[model samples]
Target: MIAVRRSETTLFTSREATHDNDTVALTHRAGLVRQFGSGLYGFTPTGERVRRRLIDAVDAELRAIGGQRISLPQLNYSGIWERSGRWESFEGEMFTFENRDGKRLCLAPSHEEGVVHLVDGAVRSYEDLPALYYQVGRKHRDDHARNGLLRLKEFTMKDAYSLHADADSLDETYERVRAAYVRLFEALDLAFVVAAAENSVMGGSASEEFVAPVETGTLDLRHCTAEDCRFGVTDESPGWASVGGICPDCGGNLVAGEGIEIGHAFKLGTRYADAMDLTVDGPDGDEWRVHMGSYGIGIERLLHTILAQQSDDAGCRWPDGIAPFGASIVPLAYEGAIRETADRLYRELGAGETLLFDDPGQTIGERFAESDLLGIPRKVVLGNQFRETGAVELECRDGTTRYVDPDEVAAVVSGTRSGD
Candidate 1:
């Protein structure tokens, strides 16, 4: 129950916002985010609450699948990149700088090199064949940073690395991680598609990207419509448009749609192992290289995509599992029985954990406006009807409303109680 007073909050004024086809204008107008620089934004109290909810959902999904959470240094030594043969190739896009000691370093845009080095020192025997490590932290990139959270100079990423002794083991682990991502997105109530992807700079034989369609997205994918078919490929592939968007596997016609790429999984095989001489004692007493895979979810980009997909003329409509607050308590009349009923309902909703108590200083209209702006899934209003008929009105973000007893408001919002 997070208590909030509209008067005390510093939300973005309408005049301070500019409309765009993405989340920039809506989020700012609602006072959820504030722009600090190009591709950089600051989350307000309300925004941070939503962000944490998203992080918590992803973190739980990762841990449930044998992923051990670990933190690595953001500033990495250039020696690591050089050993991996990406130092020179990545020069134009790596954030490189020299320290006072003349030691070369760069903020890691990804953790392939770091993960390989860390795992090399930890696992020395075949007994540690299958190790899954993950970290949720900040990653820096030299991207041109555009389209709100779609691209940024700095962002948060949940990256998981798996080490295996054989190709079969790597494949199994990759599928498991991919399934975990499916669950994470389902929990977030995001509709997405998994499509074959190019490995590009992250040297690997195969890759797949999890994408969600949005009007302002930059990636275009052509998907097959054949029954039980899941084939989707990037539009950049040669002859994709000329083939009438055909699915290579099923010979089905493809339909093209634009989507924002949220997650990617790669089968890295022995690229890093061979480059860095990463090895362990095999079961037969011979040294063998490890097979690896990398999985990543762009935290900020995912959140922005969700908001863009779920938002409407009102504001953000967060899914139940990731909403900052389950519901809001708006008291139409600040005094008399109305306030009493509202106060009782607020306390019943766990006193700030599951419900938001709108400030009484604002008018009913003002409270409703703020309530809609924040997009709380359920809104309990104690107004004239409550004072007259002893029934409070429950309004959903979708504009559905019904009257219910004040004592049952909390349970109703929490999905524990049923009926009007």
Candidate 2:
């Protein structure tokens, strides 16, 4: 069985960042429901489950790549944009203001400028080349936003930038990160395609977007049916025949689809270094503009897509991988013998992972529906009248119901494979 979270902790807190396991994360996600506000979230239990899972997956992947989230101020450095020639173009869309010192400042739409400036302040030579710095933090945009969390004015982003000495080193890290992004999305159980793309708005020569195919997507993808090819994304209007060579996995024909762009990686090719005067002395003692690459993933968008992909009429059936609570246990009867037995079983099962024990006051139907809407994967029904002796009712959201012994839950949990 996929390991699950045991409890929730404060966001960006030292403990939350350090606890990388499954159970604690689910509890963490369960806690997110409390903070979701009027502008961005509707707060469905299943949605929270999906959101937590996606974040956990990406956070884990970034750690594997030697990255971590770091906090910086929400506003700073108006001159930095002017130095980069972005000050005018970014005018309205940037959340700008004058600081107490009368210096200009703005909220960051992207972290490239901030990261570059920070590194420039820290490094002075070849030894600092290939320094990788990343942060998963809140970002803001001043544009109109109404697409749920998919397009929010303020959201969380995981952005990493690598500074390199040689083009070869940059390329190696580039591909390494591409692979990392693939695995990150895969861990979240998202179907995605890394497409060759243009830095149309960003004005870069090299770039690609990791897109997830969703009905509400804004980007397009083309893939071929040829037996030997497996390409899916291109910036130009190439027909499927040209872009897709074959389905590398099964040799099946490939097709084109609209995709929601979620993550991206780009080669800066000294663009930002030049704009910001971020250069380091080379081995020959010559000043060299550091080769740079920027990679980003919208953590909130992943949450949105996860919700769109797995939820249904009854509610969400979040996979065990991401569910905040492994199961929502409801003791059907409250008084006398049943309550006592159920309370005992709940304590026993609670020992496994995070558990939201629904007390035995609501009717059976209410309990079941609430559990369904809450989208917890498994439901343990502790009713004294269970026809079977020495066993409680175990129900999976994926239409699995069984009268099972409480002690055997791990075995049954192991058998499920629906999601997250």
Candidate 3:
């Protein structure tokens, strides 16, 4: 589909990369986990915690929009692929094959077909004109492959499609989705650009990519260094935006940067509506083609992106709301009764305070070394002397150490640490 949005005035505009103060991913054992990709990552309880927190934020944003996550099957058949003609165009980008029955199937590359198949069965009127359907599930791609989890063959993604009655209706949904995306990224604490983008394959006019730039992210975007620009961030994806003396949405000055497109929203208009003959009868009994748009965000990619942007050198530093387990309990002892103290402390830590007990069989050096690798924010050293003093030597991954009493452990975890 032809891009309908008017092009910006600038030529050869350079995209700026993200300026995060910190970006790190915590991996347990790499180049050693046989059969896994080089960057193939399996989240530690801590890493998983970080991923879930980001996911919860996304889902909460979706739920606020009355959207929900649904699962789509991994194997989708030839009928839809042939129907969309994606069977031919998808090429190496798509993972496709056939079973004994000779049905062309894919790893359900995208749910556009699946969703369309669903819509094809139910809605018959413009009263059903505006339907927004979304899913958070695994998607398959014949990826170019990469380091870490940036680009993977199989990963989670969120695809939302909106069906509307007219251009104005589609535009409204587009704007709402766009706003939600902005809020969503901001909530994740990453800088992103909403650049005017080309709908490479999804087939649409006027698309915007919500790119979040990280030092080593797979997606690249150009944006402004000055974060105050009201035009939001210009996407260097297809790179279009006119910068006059003033901002389009505000009077603020304009600036730029590079962005990693974590999300994209497209105004399909009647492209799919016409392709699939999705005409609906209006409440006034008028028949009209449903105007449509599709929004997509790679969920697992987002998880990796969050881990990329949010962590420190130690490990995945997940935000409090999303850490898989809140605390990592490391029992660093070189003396008597250390084991018993750790056991006692573990039993009495408090309600819902998840901890990983590192009862040392290794040297002090090994225990400390592992602590850096297993980066739970707050590390509680269950030492022998703790029971006497009524506290443990608390080590923070953010670089602070102290004697935290049982009473103050909650305080520290509750973020009361002056050192945190």
Q: After superposition, how far is residue 339 of candidate 3 from its true place, in Å?
A: 4.2
Ranked by TM-score from best down, the candidates are: 1, 2, 3
Tens-digit per-residue lDDT, 1-420, candidate 3 = 011100211111112212232332133331111225643445543444455566667777777876655666778887777776667777788888878888767887677767777778478877776777787777888877664466777776778888888899888878888888888877666666566777767777888777776676554434454465424444344435445445556565544444456888888777766667777888788888878888888766776566677666544554445544455556655345666655555555534354544433555555555545444566677665575765788877777878866656655666643235
lDDT scores for all predictions? 0.80, 0.65, 0.62
Error of 2 at 106 (Å): 0.9
| Top TM-score prediction, candidate number | 1
Native-referenced Cα lDDT, model 3: 0.62
Query: Distance (Å) between predicted and true CA of 121, model 2?
Result: 4.2
The most accurate candidate by lDDT is 1
lDDT of 3 at 334: 35
Expressed as tens digits, the lDDT of each residue in 1-420 for candidate 2 is 222221222221112321232322332333333335422444344345456566777778878887656666668688777877777767677788887898988888887777777777568888877766777777888766644566676778888888887677788888888889977776666767666777644545588877776655556665544533435664432233354545545666667666667888998777877778888888889998888888888877766566556566664445446765667666665556555655565555554443544443458676677666556677777765453475777777777678877677556655655431
lDDT of 1 by residue, 1-420 (tens): 455544456545353577665477877777777778987878888778888888888899999998999999999999999999998878777899999999999999899999888887779997887999999999988888787777988888999999998899999999999999988887777877778777878887898888786777878877776765656666644444555656777998877778888899999999999999999899899998999999999988988898888887777777765665667778876677776777677678755354444555567787677667777777888888887899989888887799988777776777732122
Residue 357 error, candidate 3, Å: 3.0
Indicate the worst ten consecutive residues by lDDT in candidate 2: 10-19
List ranges where model 2 is wrong by over 4 Å: 1-53, 99-101, 221-230, 234-256, 351-353, 357-361, 384-387, 410-420
